[model samples]
Target: MLLQSHLRSVNPDATTIENAAFVAYRKDATNPDHFIPVVPSESIAEAPYILHLLPALPPAWPNGHIEGLRARGGCEVDVTWRNGALASANVRAPHGGSLRLYADGSLSKTIRLGAGETIAWPLP
Candidate 1:
């Protein structure tokens, strides 16, 4: 897809995802270094299926950013940044998802994500 590389923004004019057969992420959620597979989805049965480029082992971490992840439910999630440590970083809701985060063994805050949306939160 033609795209513009920038932060906190997707050039809607240039950015677009199409024909994604299914979403896949690491098995050991939170651990970027894990296996990922794109299986068919029962949720989106009528949706078209198109397998994009197969994913490969992540080479590095995004500031402890779980290197790899799969789109569970329907919405995709991400932790823009964390203060120290991350306790939870996964999205689990079909239409909209909510996830809790913790740092230094302390509950950070609750995160809510909408479908096809990216949320940036601060972790204590």
Candidate 2:
């Protein structure tokens, strides 16, 4: 329910809007039922969004408990729209990275590279 709460906090309109979809997935194969939301594509389209990572605890197995283990990390997505297009960036913490987009109404191609990265593609 943390994800639901988080989404509510980030986008209040989401609660009132219909046709919004939320999905979850488990990162570890051993715990298939342990699902969590990974990417919120639709919600991300909403400007000025926030993403939170919840705390983690090691799973109990064979009647044993373990401590000192913590969840990987978390991120907060901040989006802004300008001139009839959506522009946003993701700020990742504990490990830092960012994703930005420059979109137009029709079709557009943009390549982003960071620190010794190379990308090749075709434009249509």
Candidate 3:
């Protein structure tokens, strides 16, 4: 198999396809994969609605106003991936604040939300 061959070349004694694929996919500098975000459901239960951000964003959306589940002073976002790329995001911010998107320890994007607003922001 291609995975086994790749692994054998990488590590003579290695045998797991999952690990090999993860390393290869993540280290592919030419076309690195998108970072996926994880949101805890319990964090924003009553905010309002969910923002479904797609790879292709819509033309017009309200400024800093998104519909989502109302929560505390923070925001919660969920990510969707397709074919190793980011597909969409569902963001919820009840009290309104800065929603920062990060890749590991690096900051990627920042969005500001109004009170009880939810946004689906597309990431590049």
Between prediction 2 and prediction 3, the one with superior TM-score is 3
Tens digits of per-residue lDDT, candidate 1, 23-105, equal: 45447676767877755446444332211111221334323444234443344434323333332443334466543332232
lDDT for model 3, on a 0 to 1 scale?
Answer: 0.37
Index of the highest-lDDT prediction: 3
- Misplaced by over 4 Å in model 3 are 1-73, 103-109
- Measured by TM-score, the strongest candidate is 3
What TM-score should be assigned to candidate 2?
Answer: 0.19
Q: Model 2, 3: alpha-carbon shift in Å?
A: 12
Ranking by lDDT: 3, 1, 2
- Each candidate's TM vs. the true structure? 0.28, 0.19, 0.34
lDDT of 2 by residue, 53-90 (tens): 12121233112222222222233323333332333322
The global C-alpha lDDT for each of the candidates, from Candidate 1 onward, is 0.34, 0.28, 0.37
The number of clashing residue pairs in each candidate reads: 4, 0, 10
Counting only residues 3 or more apart in sequence or on different chains, how many pairs clash (N, Cα, C under 3 Å) in candidate 2?
Answer: 0
Candidates 1 and 2, the one with greater lDDT: 1
